[model samples]
Target: MSTPKLYAGLKLREIRTNLGLTQKAFAGKLGVSLPYLNQMENNHRPVSAGVVLALAREFRLDVTELSTDDAERIVSDMREALADPVFGPAAPPIADLRLAASNAPALARAFLDLHRAYRRTHERLASLDEALDTKDATLRPSPWEEVRDFFHYCDNYIDAVDRAAEHFASPAGRPGDPMRAAQEALAHQGVTFTRADGPWLRYFDPDTKQLTLSSRAPGSTQRFQALHQVALLAQNELLEATLDLARFQTAEARAIAKIGLANYFAGAALMPYRLFMAAAQETRHDLERLADRFGASIEQVAHRLSTLQRPGAKGIPFFFVRVDQAGTITKRHSATRLQFARFGGACPLWNVHRAFETPGRFLRQLAETPDGVRYLCLAREVSKPAGSFRAPVRRYSIGLGCEVQHAGALVYADDLDLTRSFEPIGISCRICERPDCHQRSVPPLERRLSVDPGKRGILPYEIGG
Candidate 1:
């Protein structure tokens, strides 16, 4: 596969400005002409190896920060935003989109903001006249989506929160049960806890200094809720600080993000990063074994595995996704080149869909994304049983995978050939580039289609160039 070019224009400019260096002086220091430096700074030219070396030597910069992460994120979000039909068939080419994301990152963000506003306004009013008459109509990213993107760009790991959770779980400078620690800490705070069969999962009555946990919930889930409440009660400042840095557009978003951070803390605490990483390595990443060892559910283990991105000590960069029976992506995170569709659902061709048919068993797929990057994907059904049989069962399929090179680390990839027999997969039909997919629910917005009444193939109509 071809490697994507790097563009660190924004980062380079920030570093230069932060160091208070003139463009001419910076160019001289980097052994490049002023015009050449200008081109690189503007992303018209790739930063050269000599320039990279110069930045490291002169500024003590961590060259790894010069990754294409920012540009890639912007490009992915822009692609999804542009897929909206309001943009029509006149959307810019992928090459132009990349240029905009790389060379004018701020403008690209502004465009996304405008699109978010357009959507919010469109949802609020039925007609243009109604829209014009509304006095308080404002545009902002949907709080939930904004938070999702925030975590997405963060590579699904909040270092501070994760470390704090690890610390909380580590009593006496040793790994211990976080749930027990939370209980002990709460007791010291004059808060008493109890378990009961109830309609609510957890209820904390601050006035009475009582926390009620559901007896019906699974042990792992109960533990998670306990830790989540602990995070809210004890770590409010840290959670708020993280959200403040995020600066979400709406209070609802901020509230939702607080819960998300607590969930992160709960998961991290249940499986302390260092101990969990060691166990994962020892077991070849066997989900069941890790879950048993950490006293976490398989789903929790899978989710935590995707968040092993703690800089320098990063694990295999895996993508974790959970889809309900309807194929909607309920939860997702990826640190790899492959990105999931922001709208609609996952590719029907992917094994995640098939996981529902064979419940209670793990399914494996050697799959390739539309970009030709391959992954060794694993999928299994996770079911939540209600207290009584009369209540509904919440069922979802969990998927976890990393690129082929990292397959060796997974126990699931024991006998499979890493290089061949890969199934083709795409993000979603709306953005998928494949023309002959039989399971496509919709034609790609990026391509035109032709209707051939007399001819038929995997697709009912031929795709136009």
Candidate 2:
């Protein structure tokens, strides 16, 4: 077998910049010529063993982080972006794509941004919002997706906000009853907390000093909403400080992101980082057990698993996804290599889609991505009752999984073969490299197709061999 080439230009450049060293100085320290260092930094050449040692010795850098899957992540993201069909059949060669991903990641991000603008414009034109009024309309990406990407790249964790929440839920602060604690906190500001029979999830009356939660919502949801209100009331300044640092591009994005951050605070506070993490480790991450222990729903527990990236006190990195019956990703966040599709729907072959059929029981899959990474995936359908039969029920399937390397830590992985068999799944059909997939939706954008009417196999057209 051929040796696997190491292309870590982004990480190399980051280390060089962080150390404030010039290319000549860096090369000297690494015992290489300046031209060689430049080539490596641009990913025109692979990072050598000598440079890896030099980095460890000179900067005390973790060599393991240097060998990360940055190239793979970027290549996956770029492939998905280029598969828009607007890019047409004239996609760049794989070598060029890899070069762009490693050497100039910023340009790749810029291209993705430009495409989002086009997609937003296309969506608006199709919707005919205001009937081509063109009033107060400018070319920009969908603010919601923009905000989502902000959190996506942040690994769905904010240290300042997460720490503040841990403090709030600490033993000294967390009261015997979370609802009572919220009432007391709000009462200090002359705000009263109560439940109301209403269509909305949560409502606040500023003039009447009242915070009202929906009576129809589940008890777990009500607790979440109460804590979310507490975040908005008690942690506005800290939230604002974090927002200022993020510097979102648009006001709508800022507003939506503020709510998202508040929601994060609510989940973190309700579960409380240190305690929840301990219970997760002890229970082997049993969703039902954690939910019962923390008075949270299984869905809430699953969602919180994705946000456990609290630096030195981190838990297992998990990817969490929630899909509606129509296969829309209403909520998604990943701290693993398996990022959910940003635009297109997920693969039909994945077990998450089958989750709706198996309600209450968890569905497990040992799946592999095109990048050769495997995961122990778990999915279950969760329902939100409308409090009465007169209204519609809100139903969704939640997916949670970690890398197969950590599968032993999960109760769901017991008796599962992590070595022998695995299901092949991709970010989506558009970018999947699996040529023999019987369920492929579209030929990969990066590959060619061959069609002969007289010949056929699993598919009418044979992908490039």
Candidate 3:
């Protein structure tokens, strides 16, 4: 097998522009001719080894940024978008999609946005009540989805926010109790803290300067709620600055993102980055042990693990997702090459779907996607009790996994035969290229289908080559 040539024109151009250098000046720094630099920047030619070395030595660049992370993500998203039935049976080839994603990412994002708008409009039109509502008829993207993509494209890592949370968690270069820090911060703001029986987990009265948490909530929940309030009261300006940088299209999205950011701050502060990263490594990425160490829940521990992409001090790239019993993905993030389905449930073959059956036990599976990527997946059911028997209990299955190559770092992979035949999985049925999938909910949009009234195999229709 030959090595794949790197074509990182977009990243090269970005680096150059950020340095405030023209093509000639940048070329001079990289010891390349202006035309040669232009060729590399335009992706007409692969970036040479000398240029990569210059980027590291002269510019102090991470060089790993030149890798195809964003490009791959864009390509995967484009593939999912094009798999829409509206695209008919003639979707563009994967090579073409890769080219567009690599050379013209902005245009690729624009196309994804257009498709998202079309999807929203189609859904609105499908429901008469929704079509009648003027508010629902707008083509504006879903605020939740818009916020999701913001974090998605950022690799679920916000540098400034993460650093600030770390500082709060470890003031004066010494590790401190985040719960205590949050309480002191709230008290300094003249906010009285108390717990009471209420349906809501956390509630704050701005006028009275009173912050209240539910008495019935667990200790971890209470601590998290306190930290979340600290984010709102103490880190308001920082959160706003981050939101401004995000530049969400709608006020709804901006508001939604503020809560998300505050939640992020809470999580980061709860499990301070350096402390958590070191503990994760020492414990071999054991979720239960990490949760016990960090005073966090299993779900919180898993979610925090996925956000360990802090550039210089990164952990193993992992994917985290939470799905309801109905199979709708409620939350998702992937630092790995495995991107989840953007608009639907995950692959049914995945162990996450079966987590509901065996309530507390962790389900493990070695699965392979159609693209030949193998992963060690772990799933367990998480339940959020409403603190009262009469109140509804919310249950979701959370999955955390990394590529098979990283399996040694996970305690859950113990005793599992990595060399065994892996269960096949996919992102979504419409985008899945596996023709013989018995669990396929729908046929792939890109393939031609042959209807055989006389005979059938796994599917009623045969997918064409």
- What TM-score would candidate 1 get against the native? 0.90
Q: Scored by CA lDDT, what does every candidate get?
A: 0.86, 0.83, 0.90
lDDT of 2 by residue, 27-90 (tens): 8989999999899888889999888888888878767666444455566677778877788877
Cα deviation at 16, candidate 3, in Å, is: 3.0
lDDT of 3 by residue, 1-465 (tens): 135578899899999899999999999999999999999988889999999999999988877778786788998999999888898768898878878998888999999998988888887678754554666436678798899999999999899999999999986756678888998999999999999998789999999999989999998899999999999999999999999999998899999999999999999999999999999999999999998988999999999999998876888889999999999999999987789888889999999999999998899999998878899999999999988879889999999999899999999888999999999999999788898989999988778899989997888999887
Models sorted by TM-score, best on top: 3, 1, 2
lDDT tens digits by residue: candidate 1, 1-465: 765667788888988998899999989888999999899888898888889899889878777668775677678778888878888977788778878987787899899888878877777665544554655445556678889878987888999999999989974556687778989878877889999988878899989999999999988988999999888988889999999899887889999999999999999989998888989999999999998887899999999999998855778778899999999999998877778887778888889889888998999999998777899999999889889979898999999999888999999999997767799999888888888888888888878889888987887877776
Worst 10-residue lDDT window, candidate 2 = 131-140
**What is candidate 3's TM-score against the reference?**
0.93
Tell me the deviation in Å of residue 356 in model 3.
Answer: 1.3
lDDT of 2 at 107: 85
Question: Over the full model, what C-alpha lDDT does candidate 3 score relative to the true structure?
Answer: 0.90
Best candidate, lDDT: 3
Assess every candidate by TM-score.
0.90, 0.87, 0.93
How many residue pairs collide in each prediction? 0, 0, 0
| Total clashes in model 2, counting residue pairs 3 or more apart in sequence or in different chains | 0
Task: Give the Å shift of residue 281 in candidate 1.
Answer: 2.7
